[model samples]
Target chain A: MPLTSPDRTTGPLMVIGGAEDKLRKRTILKEFVSASGGADARIALIPTASSLGDEVVEVYDALFRRLGAGEVVPVRPQSREEAHDPDLVKAVGEATGVFMTGGNQLKLSAIICGTPLGDAIVEAHERGAVVGGTSAGASIQSSHMVAFGVGGATPKQRMTQVAAGLGLVKSAVIDQHFDQRNRYGRLLMIVAQSPQLLGIGVDEDTCALITVEEDADEVPHEVLRVIGRGSVTIFDPASIVSNAHEAKRSSPLLASGVLLHVLPAGAAYDLTTRTLVPQPAAIDPEDAAELAEAQRDMRQLARDIAAADASPAALRRRLARTRTKIGPNPDPLEGPVS
Target chain B: MPLTSPDRTTGPLMVIGGAEDKLRKRTILKEFVSASGGADARIALIPTASSLGDEVVEVYDALFRRLGAGEVVPVRPQSREEAHDPDLVKAVGEATGVFMTGGNQLKLSAIICGTPLGDAIVEAHERGAVVGGTSAGASIQSSHMVAFGVGGATPKQRMTQVAAGLGLVKSAVIDQHFDQRNRYGRLLMIVAQSPQLLGIGVDEDTCALITVEEDADEVPHEVLRVIGRGSVTIFDPASIVSNAHEAKRSSPLLASGVLLHVLPAGAAYDLTTRTLVPQPAAIDPEDAAELAEAQRDMRQLARDIAAADASPAALRRRLARTRTKIGPNPDPLEGPVS
Candidate 1:
């Protein structure tokens, strides 16, 4: 007895893991453009994580237009007042594809959850519209979303705090910047607390396109995935050792489990069957060539950064300052010593 | 905070789903007669499903000897063979309690999974002792235990399977003879597809006694109940649902995603948390008095059937056939037809 009828969206979802500079951006754009079944499809870019300065929006608009999107809409919801704008919601509703850019996921959730715009996004997804989110955007698709955590292999109790997120996917809790950041420990800790949810660690430059089809009988939907490089590491706890109700701030994290599959690009993972297999290579040769060109452009950017006319010390200092500005700051008063 | 120290096993485990007649015989006896503390703390029993069988096991060996228990064990396997010998790898290593009892539970996970003797039951659980099973022998302890679905819920595509059990509690699945013949739809569907295991369903007038530590991290270890009145229903779905890769079956009837809970004689519910609470009022004072009187009868012989006779017609027929059979029926064609 199938739970629902099969429904397919006209466009495909594209999720990028992060570190999307000029080259990476071009590659993602090309993929999106081609997946939309021609350049005529309307595309809506949600850059909620960025400050949305005029220059950034203009640059994105130009880039998307050059990539063949007939019309590109940059959604900049700066304040709570604009977060629920009806016009923006309608634009997303009417668009063929919706893209979420990298930034702070917490901020996005804070501004979107329970709002009309949020409802519209969910509705569009259910209607089979192509919806994609990068970095933090990817992490927000689970019920028990990770706010942040220290990286390590040891499981510590209460090391991770879960917050509400967009309820798009239920089978797994996703973490971005996987291998690059050594986030396996954090993912394991999460599964220890809630063994029901599978842990999906998506590395930078990787994407997981989850497709859901209602069972023929329509009780609950079944989820399928098209996985791409680098790899998606799955953390499945064999047995849980932590207690939720009695856990305190000082509990040691302890979990014993298994890592079932670490699927690479061109792989398909079936949630219904809990299995992974090779997916038919679907990217066109032309599109693949374009992607390679975009990679070259990214390498050029990195080379330029390395060759900049500055002392190594100065460059390190500048990078640290930039990180502080973009990332979360620790509370000064809570420091270990004066 | 950490719930328990890594050095010691946390609190005792208790199962309370079946009545008194459906529990396994050997499990009950061991749990009731074991010595308290030290190695005896690792005592455990796997009751097929019921409290009566557990009680009988206690009194079977000696009329007046007081039994001190370190632990009470419950063995609810995915198949019968899994339940019978049980891979004692974990139990023997650490259990202080161990017991096995008689409800179907797909014949105790077909003698337990991954086993020389269900590795989880005899070896892992026995290391700590205090193990027992009752009425499905306290189903819901195993990771792959069973849960019955009634009340018009159909098995649709991805609607969640309604047989055998959820494997989380232990690795075994469980079903109870709940509300007499009402379990017909619940039991048959569960065992249709996933038949590599056992199905335990306890009938009325039986119980399996599993013991846990008195306190774990300051919180007392209480009996975890999987109770059901009348009859317990068990279904193993490994056989009915074909495993053909390309050929899709309509609502494969396997014992995956089964439902199991202890609906004891009580009415306490946690609406906010969506959890069950104990109902003290449901325990009849008269029954307690009768139990005391029954304890006085030192020479009573344990009978196969209870006088109350609350089992469903279908289960009664199955149990009768199984008892009369002398050898294995080699013709696979003679198995139950969907």
Candidate 2:
């Protein structure tokens, strides 16, 4: 549909699997800042999911500012009533970027799912403002949220319960702390029962940055690219065979023929076609030109070495001649003969 | 494309995950017999992938005959020249069902790919003859074949190599002995780099029975239904981030954001939409009628029990009255009062 609407430009979404680096490299946060308009960004921090009080907001505020965001404000709504407040809604609406902190996803979904603040966040995305979250924040982006579940590799009946999220990522369920927390079983259980829903599991410190792009056929599709130290795991059960409906209690389910894709940083996936998008060969023209010049020089040097037949005196004489021709600066490509 | 071409019909393909029971229930083999026209079936066995000489062919030949097939023929082509032999091609073309046995996938691909015999198999499939295989046979059904690979849960560089298959299951790569052999990493590694190819892994003693079915929109799509005891695993890497392209020799790869689906027996997946096809609520009309009648009788009996107030003498009297009304026949549902 976005393909047909040429003018419909939605902002990017960053679904961070919890414990993103606030210290050290902070690669995910830096990218978020840049995507949110860098030094011009006006960011709103939603700390409602967190059990921590002002400390969480204070930490993010300091981090965002340190990362060069223009401004940072807090929009914490402790309840549905508080979430409906106009001032809080205004704060999210006015921001160029919105970030939700990790804590309890169920608490976040219960308070934000149907409220005015949630509406504002969606509207902000509609009008092109980057929205991002970690852990609880990440899980709440999908249509079906993993409310709570046991961790294992076996899909079992009633192993997890689902809740409605803001539905930023439609027709999908997101699970955070995937490999580290071993949330594979719960995610598999969710998709086994609801095969129509795509299952996405993000590892800690990793981010699935989703952006809209046009395909070769000129159809607009959402593409997710991984950024961070860890990987993103997706479960596309096109033709699944599971006993999820009948498996009693926590019994292991028979889940067969599930298509599994594991992508690390730099892999891109096309959401519309349910396929992986190929990364373009992306070399800067200047870099390409420089590389070509360097390659040509190396070839020439190799030819000289071959002509000299590896005689130390001959090689030294050739190098000296080449240096003379290049105006006395030792040729970068030609190292001193051993 | 099959959706628009109403007259175009392809045969069902069963990709077995190896070690399907030759004894006991033999559920998968029985289904193959039934699908291949049962009592009137003429089955052809191609044991090209097997290392055992005539034994594999003899075993299948006997099994098919024992299963009540009208005719069983061996059509093994030991070389490209043998594969080109018109007689071998004729055998496969005329059979109602063609089965490939388990062994080396690479050996099978080398002999069959680009050969006249291979073309005949595709032609047979196009003409609506059932085609089935187990293990190596299963892997060789898809467009990209897993020639060889190590088994693990962590994707690494050079974990597996891809060969060409019959391309029966388009845009996919299949692996056999999946969970049992732990081939998850190799499948993941294949998809992580290729991205466009869907990765499918099947567990031992399981079969992915793929058939052509029309959707709600009347569009024809390939649906895979699971059979046997184990599960079928599918990897739909819609948005993957992987370091497959640059990961050094044998180094673990970073594969992120892979969608995984695990379907056990009776689960159906739509290959076209890359989603699960909701199973129709299947109930036999006669069975439903009997169930309804039984439920009504149970309700009446409950009412009678309530009137009797659980008095032993009253209960006995009611049972006597019921039996008398039914002409001395014991009530199927009711036991003696105790």
> Candidate 1: where is the Cα deviation over 4 Å?
A1-12, A20-28, A52-56, A212-228, A237-250, A278-338, B1-338
Stretches of candidate 2 exceeding 4 Å from the true structure: A1-187, A190-245, A248-338, B1-7, B216-218, B241-243, B281-338
| lDDT digits (tens) for residues A1-338 of candidate 1 | 11222245423444456654445455555666556433776777777766654665676667667777788787767666787898898888887777777777777777776677777777777676677777877777666678877754334456666777766666568888765565655676687777777777776776776665554565333444434435555655433333333333533332322323454445555555454543454556765786676666566446547856656776667657856886743332333223
User: Candidate 1, after superposition: displacement of residue A3 in Å?
Assistant: 8.9
In the order shown, the candidates' DockQ scores are 0.02, 0.18
The residue-by-residue lDDT of candidate 2 on A1-338, one tens digit each, is 12232224889999999999889999999999999998999999999999995999999999999999999989999999999999999999999999999999999998998899999988888898999999999999999999998765546678799999998888899999886666767888898899888899888888999988886687777889988866777887667666666565565575655656676677778777777776665555775786687777778767876878757787788778877887664453743321
Q: After best superposition, candidate 1 residue A1: deviation in angstroms?
A: 16
Instruction: Give the least accurate 10-residue stretch of model 1 chain B, judged by summed lDDT.
Output: B265-274
- TM-score per candidate, chains pooled: 0.40, 0.54
Candidate achieving the largest lDDT: 2
Q: Candidate 2 on B233-266: residue-level lDDT in tens?
A: 7887776666666576775576655656677677
